[model samples]
Target: MSTTTETLKSQWEALKAENPHMRIRNAAEKLGVSEAELVATSIGEGVTRLRPEFAAILTEVEKLSKVMALTRNDECVHERKGVYLNPDFSSPHAGLFVGEDIDLRIFLSAWDKAYAVVEKGEDRDKKSLQFFGKDGLAIHKIYTTRDSNDAAFDVIVEQFKSDNQSNEETTVAVPLDIDEKPDSEIDVDGFKAAWIDLKDTHEFFGMLRKFGVTRTQALRLAPSEEHAHKIEKDAIVKMLEGAAAQKLPIMCFVGNRGNIQIHTGLVRKTMWHNNWFNVMDPDFNLHLDMDKIAQTWIVRKPTEDGVVTAIEVFNEMGEIIVQFFGKRKPGIPELTEWRELVASL
Candidate 1:
């Protein structure tokens, strides 16, 4: 190893000795390096750098039955439990994982480094495959569960192990700034007209790109109060409570720039502690920073089946923190009870 890397490794070891419970991401920040770089330091010990064949890795992931898929941003963490099935990787820049239990939207272009992590510590022995973006931010992670196929995981890890095992210092790229148009510059009438004529909920992203307007701007330009309206930030807690009371299965989407993790089921437990609104269930947990929620909107979109409504929460920077929707299939319409619950909010 180079002098600089050797010094970094010593520093990291010292930091770990100081606080063994520190997460790797936090440790990387404390050491002024990326998480990928820190994990690379343990290449031969418990980490194996994987070749950047994300699609192939995902295909192998399907064989490791009953794994937990985790995706997160700075403010929210989403975890789902299921097998990675029905993966569609035909697109060069994007991929889709359409499974009944584990649903994901993968942006292939942003995916950069990958590693298979195996940590046998005093307390626990954990195994996982972690993927990172160009900026060294985590895109997605797949962890082995009690019911997972450990043999399959071991085989895939060996299959994709990189030839290069050097632990060299690396630099992370700066994230690009989004060029969002101002609300005033958007054609309010035209945007509203197009929104009203929307055929499917999936077209919402296309509509935003076509008008060159951000999501918050579009919500502000909604034609009528019925179409879009701001709600109290605490409404999220109420919505969750109501859903649980009604036994309503809902879909929650939390994503970063590279991947979106979804949870579709009835949330049975809700807790608020330290300004975090959380769904603490046995298999799924959603931790959302309530203080980061700067705005909440009830948005309505016209679909072939009927008008679909959603509760979208945004942070101060106009980035979506989390979205909630009533669980319904494509051919079926939104639940009347869910619509009533949204209206009550």
Candidate 2:
């Protein structure tokens, strides 16, 4: 190893000795390096660097059986427990995981660094596969549960292990821009006309790109109050409570640049603690930074079934933190209770 890398490794070790509970992400920040770099230091010690063949790795992930899939951004963290199955990698840059319990939209381009980590616990070793973006931020992670196939995990880890095991310092580029356009410059008339002509909810992203406006900007200039109305910041908590009370099944979508993790079911427990709103359940957990939510909107989109409504929350950066929708299939109409619940907000 080079002198600088050796020094970083030593510093990381010393920091771990000082506080063994310090997370690797926090430790990387403390040492002024990327989390990938910090993890690379322990390549041979319970950690193995994997080749950046994300699709193949995901295919192999199916063998691990039951595991927890985790995806997070700066303001939201989503975790779901299930098996990884039916991964469609037809597009090199984009992929899909269409499992009943674990649903994910994968953007493979953002995923650059991959690693298989084996952490020693009090009783046994905890194994995981972690993926990072070009900026060295975590994109997605899969953790092996107690019921996971340990033999399958070991085989895949050994198969995909990288030959180059050097503990070298690495540099990361600045995060990608969101391609946002100023609201003042956007042609409001054209944007409104296109918004009104929308046929499917999936076309929303293309509409934004066509009008050169950000999602938040489109919400602001949505032509009519019925189409998009601003809501109280605490509306999320209200919606969650309402869902729980009515026993309404809902879909929660939380994602970063590289992946979108979804939880579709009934959320029984809604919790608030330390300025965070959380959905704490047995199979899924959602942690949202309530303080970071600068705006909340009730957005209506026309689908073939009917006009579907959603509760969309945005962070201070105008990026979506989390979105909530009434659980309904593509052919089914929106639930009347859900619409009423959102309207009550």
Candidate 3:
């Protein structure tokens, strides 16, 4: 090991010894390094650096049977337990793992480094496969469950293990800054017309790009209150509680720049811890920091079947934190109960 890496390892060990409860991401922030960098410090110590055939590795994850897929951003963490199913890697730019229990939207181009980790717990060893982006931010993670196929996980780890095990730093890239056009410069009439004439909810992203308007900006100019209206931040709590109370199946989407993890089912349990609002279900868990929610909008979009409704939350910086939707598929209209629930809000 180089002198620098050795020094970092010692420092990290010391920090962990000081506070065993500090999460790796928080520790990395405190140590002034990327989370990937800190994980790389333990390269050969129960941590195997994996070759960057990300898509291929994902295809094999289904063999693990039951595992927990985790994806997070600054304000939200999404965890869903199920088998990785129906991987569509046909697109070079992105990928999809579509299933009833586990659904994911993977952006292949954002992935950079990967590692298979085995951490010693009080009773048994915890194993996981973690992927990071070019910016050293986590893109996605797959962890072995109590019922997971450990043998399959080990096989995958060995199959994709990289020859390089050096505890070297991850090459960090600067984040891109895409400037949005000023609201005054945007064609308000054209944008409003397009929004009202939308055919599908999926076209919303394209519409934003076509007009060079930011997501929040578009929400602000959403034609009228019927289309989009801001609600109190704590509306998330009510939404979750209401869905759970009525046995309503809802969809929760949490994502960052690289991946969007989704949970599509009923949320039964919910609670508040400090400022965090959480859904503590058996197969899925959603942790959302309510304090970070700057704006929560009840948005309505036109679809072929009918109008689709969503509750979208955004952070202070105007970046999306999480989105909630009624459980419905293409060609199916939004649930009347869901609309009534939103109306109640």
Q: Report every candidate's CA lDDT.
A: 0.87, 0.89, 0.91
Off by over 4 Å in 2: 17-21
* lDDT per residue as tens, model 1, 1-345: 777777878889999999998977789888888888787777788888899898999988989999989888767888888999899989876798987789998888888889999989575568999999766778899999889998999999999999987887355686645667767788878889999999999999999989888888889888898889999988889999999889999999999888888888899989988888888887788989887789999999999999999999998888888999999889999999999999999
lDDT of 1: 0.87
Cα-based lDDT at residue 296, candidate 1: 97
Model 2, global lDDT: 0.89
By TM-score, rank the candidates, best first.
3, 2, 1
The TM-score values for the models, in the order shown, are 0.94, 0.95, 0.98
lDDT of 2 by residue, 1-345 (tens): 778877888999899999988878778888878888887788888889888888999998889999999998878889999999898999865799988789999998778988999999898789999999877888999999998998999998888888877777366786656677767788999999888888889889999989889888899899799999999988899999889989999999999889999888899998988998889998899988888899999999987888999999998788888999998888899899999999999
Q: On TM-score, who's better, 1 or 3? A: 3
Name the better of 2 and 3 by TM-score: 3
**What are the RMSD figures for all models against the true structure?**
1.8, 1.7, 1.1
Question: Top model by TM-score, which number?
Answer: 3
TM-score, candidate 1, is 0.94
The Cα error of candidate 1 at residue 85, in Å, is 0.8
